[model samples]
Target chain A: MSGASVLYDVPGPKAKVRNRIYSVLGALAVLALIGFIVLRLSANGDFDPARWDIFNYAGVRNSIRDGVLATLQVFAIAAVLSLAVGVLLAVARLSDHRPVRWLATGFIELFRSIPLLITIYAIWVLLLNNRTELGLSDNQPQFWALVIGLTVYNGSVQAEVLRAGILSVPKGQREAAYALGMRKTQVMTTVLIPQAVRAMLPTIISQLVVTLKDTSLGYIITYEELLYSTRLLAGNTTVGGENPYVQVIIVTGAIYIAMCLALSALANWIERRGRRAKTGIGVVEAGDVGNAGALTAAVAAEAAADTTADTAN
Target chain B: MNVLLDYLPEFRAGFLGTLAITAASAVIALVLGVLIAGFRVSPIPPLRAFGTAWVTLLRNTPLTLLFLIAFFVVPKILFQGASPFVLGMLALGLYTSSFVCEAIRSGISTVPVGQAEAARSIGLSFTQTLRLIVLPQATRTVLPPLSSIFIALTKNSAVAGAFSVTELFGYAKLLSDKGYAIAVIFLWVALAYLLITFAISGVFRLLERRMGVAR
Candidate 1:
């Protein structure tokens, strides 16, 4: 086992035993700590089930639901807009024109560096001053500000992800497109982007997941997202000296986890589909045009040839 | 503007608390992140699983919820109760550790497999191999994303305000509650956050250039 195993051997029995011990110890420590806290809370009567009843109360229900809807609305708008903005900037940055590339670089860097909170707060404050002129009131300012701020920051991040994905497409694909007498724009639009995007769909979906979680930042500016709703509910309800805040917080946290897990599942599915379809479409080999497995072999051959050329030099 | 002057003491305390929390939590998270990253890439399945679950939960959930659980739920579950400051630090450190884990793991993965094998063949112990052969290379790859996460943590310190922790934004909220001019108070709060953010980004810029030269 020792000699035959490669340097990065997938794990042996001793390592497995050691891992189990560590896991058990860690789990016990955390559970014990939790137990101690629960015991103390029970002694203080904080753990009484009566405290959680406010969750079922009509006012709390309405506010929480309304908050969820508002959060979803903002997330939907920002996710779509950010992807569009990301692609535009990614393309601009790749543009051969000097000014287009410069402008794109600056825009991405400026928003990417700024904290999302400042962007939202700044937009909120700025809009507040021009509320009447813009035909809006105070409440509208917070909502719009959250949307715009999230769009800018997430959009910048997405731009980088998209650019990396697009650039990751092999040079041969671009050269072959050009070899066919295709224009620069035509090569990008017709040949490179689709293949690059398919290759990078997993990373793109991962960013969208980040965008969704960032929506909770809207709570800072009082945009009434899920966290905000929970806070308002917790504050407005009273469960004696102990505050029913703990139960309400756990419930709300679980909701967020559910949404994030759902997004991850979707991303995983897309990655599988993309993997199956990737070979048949990119850089068509003359002899392997209709055969899927043959296309993979053709690509592998091209890659091996390229490596040989580099080594031969 | 006169309203802004009334809560100067609260604002000062909040501002100082936020800075202290960010610095302390950032340090703790960096250390924890490195350890978790080691566990993640360890040749042990259980360790790898632990690392994976920690990253998945921490990265997936909103930081605000983490703050709440640390401040309210965890305390109720652990000590029956805890101070907002302790809870805030715990939450922020734990939350930041996850991102740190990801960045460091990415950094470590970028170091070629052959490098580690070469270190081992030369008679380096596992720990020595990591310390001498692996980490320096990983640090360079990790700096940019690590800086971004640090900036994020600074902004997230504002969430402590929600738990009644008197960070900068907490003080601003206090002033607003006290009938001070909301705009002026928030403007000052924004300035405080900006000063911290800009300073962190400035340091990262210097590091990036120096690393570029070293490479």
Candidate 2:
């Protein structure tokens, strides 16, 4: 609040000034580093017209495009499955039946405890070993491995998020739903889960971002995802050169950054929309309102005077 | 099960390698994470940006990708070779630091600004304020998340097997390649990993309760 800010500046003037100076110096140092890198790169013929021939290789582009698509396919499937799994696990954990709760808890904890990469690797190894007997293909083995691994780990996290969201819902809502003679399942499905999800949309979105980022793990099983494609590019015998490695890495990193930033932007938009949809009654009222408002205003004014007095010393 | 027994020594060696990689990487991650977290919150804009960019880049890429980059790309560019163990540690360290940075940032944010002000008001220097007031509180609040990250780190170290580091899973794979039953060896490997993870989680839970950090 403006009044609160006036009363107690978050960081004092000295610290603020020092911070600004340090920021400017730091920015310049980084700019200089970038400039140096650019100059060195160009001098080393990294940006030469000859090196542009590498992109003309159709196979390179095709593989990358396919990799991108495959990555997206797995990510999309995993996200939806993980969220569904999370919701089921959350509901079961919250069930009135002791066995259901314990089972859900154990499932969530077990999968979540294991490393995601290990889970993926284990599943892949298992599928590969059983493929001949089960009449499955190599691709299915890796694909299923990635999907199941992502689901189990992300689902557990989502369960925790969902549980927190559900607990955050007021007790009165559940009681009222039950009073209406709604069965437990109906109360949960119609009342608790929806409200909890709506309330916890940001956390859910954040987890989704995490899930999207995690899809790159498919690279471990040689799933030919975006990262694997990039690895192929790095090791390309066709584009042999002194230092295509850094260029490939820098470009690949930028692509990843672009996608992640897009996801973050989407999350920000969703958060804004969520805030806009809030009912007036549910909003946390600022302290500078109601009967206490007058007292707070006076106290704030007194605090401001004291701050000024201290600063003038 | 007999297949597992036949390769008990290999499993033992693999378990040790896994433990070594996980512990080494955990130490590196914690130190790297703390430094990066500090840089992220520093008043310096470029340092903060660098930290943020580092976290973003690492978090977005798969851990396997990082390992490949370290093993394949880094050595290629630097015109040197890094052992699989070193490469795995470097990659895991880098990857884990991003999540750890976020955790530390969240923890730092949870510490009341009033606390810092109170420390400063009492004539404590900025360094002293951070060391005594800010860090202790941040470390406490971030314990559970930190523990979870450690467990995740241990699991992720399994990726080292992919690069032929001969860790637990890699060991199991070798046993299978020698015409042994894979399902049996894999189950043993999985159980080994599960046991380690459960033990770590148990310790974490106990610590959390003792520290009154449990919700």
Candidate 3:
């Protein structure tokens, strides 16, 4: 993509001189903001050496490790569960049966409309109150609340994403499969879903990243996850006669940023690998799955492009 | 359901509080999103770098972590006596703004290159080209994604409830703690949120049609 740089003219002699001034001033302004924050934080003991020493403690280190592990455990289960839920819902939404399609639609939209915190808390309470009646393990409410909540919300989102991917597959592929005497289920499973999964891998992975980030919400329900662990450490500790919230924040925040960036980098790498693997289909730059109108247009554009490709072949 | 009827005032307050947070944060996210989008596409390298850093960091960090920082760290390090509502707005707005910036940036990319080149050829400055040509077209086409982001902002405003803002989602705990049934509380709260989200979706649909944005 040539991008939006063409909005400006090429720099001449006077423009070059002005550009230098703007660049210098811009750099200085950014640095100044950074400097101001640093100064303010230091003045508040955030940068005190003692505040930074908490990580050296074995207990603190262990707490963080456990927190990260718990967070990942929840994320792993939720990610898998959500993807499973997504596929089922997407298929049901696409089902030929009217009632089945409407039920899936209703379920997806209902969960999507409600915030996840409410869902998790509601599920937690319901599970707690009905533990005996539902025959559920008592201690598992927090874990299940978080897992089900993430599963439902992310699953709904992924359903839309997968549906978009499915619809974007050229109509000829499904038609060809049907002409070969394939059953509807066979056509969907062997033809549509695989290609849909492949085409929408980037979007699917990014949504997974969202799930990973959202695992932090476990702190809200006292799940003792990463954020909760660090929060306890931050709240209970004292350094140089003051709480080192800023220091804890900086460290905890960095871990999150690092984890997320690593995931994103992996996604980019996989996408690049996919492009190099002689894939006939191109990955559409997917945006919000909730944009049904835009999604329709994008998928249509993709199908048209693939149709033209088929003609050329 | 009777709990909601009995506590109609509390329920109404919670719903209105949620709306207030969403509305306030929506404004902040939009303004910051636009400014950062400009910075991302600007000629100045450092400004562009700053914009990229802002989006990357904010987008990666979870909204809960942001709210934690806003509530805990900011009060101690930056300023004291900052209300939870203000801090929640800043946190939610800052987090959502990254998504907003990305959407707008992609929208910028979708504007036909010929439009920009044509405006540049007419001796228009960068800002002039953006104002007169690029942004108008970009914003028009960008509504669908923008609406999605704002709807996300509305849902995310629920995170504020956990941060002690006593919004709609926070009412979940309140009504439940009062011995009301969880299912009933969820039904009413879910309905309230459905009202907000559907209203948001409906408004955007109206706006999209009014703008005659292309399908």
Strongest candidate by TM-score: 3
Instruction: Tell me the spans in candidate 1 whose CA falls farther than 4 Å from its real position.
Output: A1-27, A40-46, A56-59, A175-185, A240-242, A276-313, B1-20, B41-50, B74-87, B108-144, B158-215
lDDT of 1 at B94: 88
List the pairs of residues colliding in candidate 1. Answer: A37-B77, A37-B78, A37-B79
Q: Compose the digit string of candidate 1's lDDT tens values, residues B1-215.
A: 56546667776787799889999889989999999987776654556667888888887788767876786667545654667877888888888898788777767766777787888778775567777888887788677667767877887777777667778876765665565556677667766776887888699889978876343
Q: Model 3 clash tally?
A: 0
What lDDT does candidate 3 reach at residue A289?
A: 32
C-alpha lDDT of residue A91 in model 3? 97
Docking class of 3: medium
Chain A only, candidate 1, TM-score: 0.79
Model 2 segments beyond 4 Å from truth? Answer: A1-49, A132-135, A240-245, A280-313, B76-79, B123-125, B202-215
The B-chain TM-score of model 1 reads 0.90
lDDT of 3 at B67: 92
Q: What is the TM-score of each candidate against the true structure?
A: 0.74, 0.81, 0.93
Best by lDDT: 3
True contacts kept of 3: 0.64
DockQ of each: 0.22, 0.26, 0.53
What's the residue-level lDDT of A227 in candidate 3?
93
What does DockQ come to for candidate 1? 0.22
Encode model 2's per-residue lDDT on B62-162: one tens digit a residue.
Answer: 56657767875556444367688888888888888887777777677667778877886787754566668877788876766676677777777877887
**Lowest summed lDDT over 10 consecutive residues: which window, candidate 2 chain A?**
A284-293
Residue B211 in candidate 3 has what lDDT? 79
